[model samples]
Target: MKFMHISDLHLGKRVNEFSMLEDQKDILRKILKIADEEKPQALLIAGDVYDKSIPTVEAIQLFDDFLCELSKRKVQTFIISGNHDSAERMAFGGRLMKESGVYVAPVYAGKTQAVVLEDEWGSINIYLLPFVKPANVKRFFEDEQIENYTDAIRVAVEQMKLNTDERNVLVTHQFVTGAKRSESEDISVGGTDNVDASVFDEFDYVALGHIHGPQKIGRETVRYCGTPLKYSFSEIHHKKSVTIVEMKEKGNVEISTKELAPLRDWCEMKGTYMELTEKAYYENLDQDSYMHITLIDEEDIPEAVRKLQVIYPNLMKLDYDNQRTRGKAAFLEAAEVEEKTPFDIFEELYEKQNNQEMNEEQKKLIHDLVEKIWEGGH
Candidate 1:
């Protein structure tokens, strides 16, 4: 059986303070187009189908439409909730949706839930482990104390182990080992909400999520499918992709990845004003690509970005090296300089406002006035 694996669609997400509903719709449509061309038997969405716990009405409709499309094509879909998803909301009507070949696992009731799919070759037992904090799992267990990611994941994995299916696949969302995080990802309290890669021991293959970069954890059997687009400026260099796993039989599996082209690339460039002005410097740059330009000139650049945007119109930021231009001595000698205190600055401005300089007697009179005010005699 061949399965297309994707994650972190983050539908209803806003990018650059702009509504990303259209971008999301275009990407999902493209994904379904690819799936139709490839004709995969099953589709595995690891986690974080929506960008927020409370998704917008438009987001809900987008997902509902996508699920209906997959159902129409007789494609089996397995989805699990992530940190950003509301468990109860995702699981709503899940039982009814399962009849249409869609499996939504939002909460871990007592054990891990597996959607069994069979083809001409054999049967594949795919387990969905939704995102859960260690405290929540500990509360669920009520007896044993779960301290960290490893402990909580162990509970779910142990439940999955009960099923002795030959070909088993685990779909999960967590901060797994060897995966890189995007800036947009929510950090747990003190970064303590992470699971080690060792927690998934017995599964034949693991499709992971939460991290925005696709990577293998300790072994090739466990991998993150990553997000479909660059969610943050920190993820500017990310090349998003979806994984396709073809299971032959038992332990033998072939995993292939296909890149999902983003709407545009995010780039960060740094150079002196003179260099940036040269035609050859940015000749290869895509004019429509989003960019952050850092000007390393001796002074503030007034028209640097304005000029560059003539070449690269989609420039988002322009920073000048003004601090470095002042030199280290300026900062180091600050204490030694004749700097005015707040009161002194205020007095000087006041004198300027009155269009006259304050004599020693006048200064002394102002000081007396301030003292009288301090004494509540205003």
Candidate 2:
């Protein structure tokens, strides 16, 4: 049996406040092209089918249209809910979609409820463990003590093993081993949100998500299918791809990855004002590509952005380099506001003001009044 696995689609996601729907659509079209060529038995979307809890009408239409095409081709699709997805919304009409070989696992109503798929080789049970909190699962199993995300996934995997045969795969939306998170990722409480790859030891293979980079965890059996399009400028170096797994009857699998080039590129540049405007720095500025610009100007250059925009009109940022500025000493000194308290500054200001405007008698009265207040603290 052969299949394609990918995750963190984050469809309908915006980049730099710009709609990335066209880029996402292009990538999905490429994925469909790959599917057409390979004709895989199954297509697994691990999680994050949408970018938000409530997706837009266009997002819904795009996903629906994609699924309808897959259904027409008799392709079996398995999807789960990610941290960004609303489970109830994703599961809407899930029962009816199952008839078309599209399965969406969102609710945790029971342990035995999993999507099972098959091919000429044998049956493959897929346990779709969506993003779930420990507290929510605790209500389902009152006697079970769950502590974190790791614990929650362990319980789900254990339940799946109880109901399925040996030839089983775990499709989950979670932070796991071998995943490299970008700066844009929201770090969870205490930074202990990720589950170890070893947690899925019982399953034949693990299709993971949440991280935007494709990687192999602990072993080749556990993998992450990165997002088709780059989510942030921090992900400029990432090579987005999908994992193709070929499974044999003996429970052995061969894996190969195919890269998915995005419709637009994300480019970043750092240079002084003159260098930035030079032909060497931005010779190939694609107006279509998203950009982040860091300016290394010694001083605030007038109309620096206007000048640069003439060359790279899509520039997203312009950062000043304080170190190179002539008045940096004053800038640094102005930033040391925490070293002294308000009372210290108030006393200094009183002396300065008295010296500038008050007579000796007035100064004496002010000193005496402040002295009495200071003595109260003693």
Top model by lDDT, which number? 1
Stretches of candidate 1 exceeding 4 Å from the true structure: 189-191, 272-283, 302-313, 322-378
Candidate 2 Cα outliers beyond 4 Å, as residue runs: 110-112, 162-165, 279-281, 285-287, 324-378
Query: Which candidate tops TM-score?
Result: 2
Clash count for candidate 1 is 0
lDDT of each: 0.80, 0.78
Clashing pairs in 1: none
| Residue 23 accuracy (lDDT) in model 2 | 84
Q: Model 2 over residues 87-161: C-alpha lDDT tens digits? A: 999999989988899989857763636566667766777778788777766777777767877777777677664
Q: Give the TM-score of candidate 2.
A: 0.82
**Model 1, position 255: C-alpha lDDT score:** 89
TM-score of 1: 0.79
TM-score of each: 0.79, 0.82
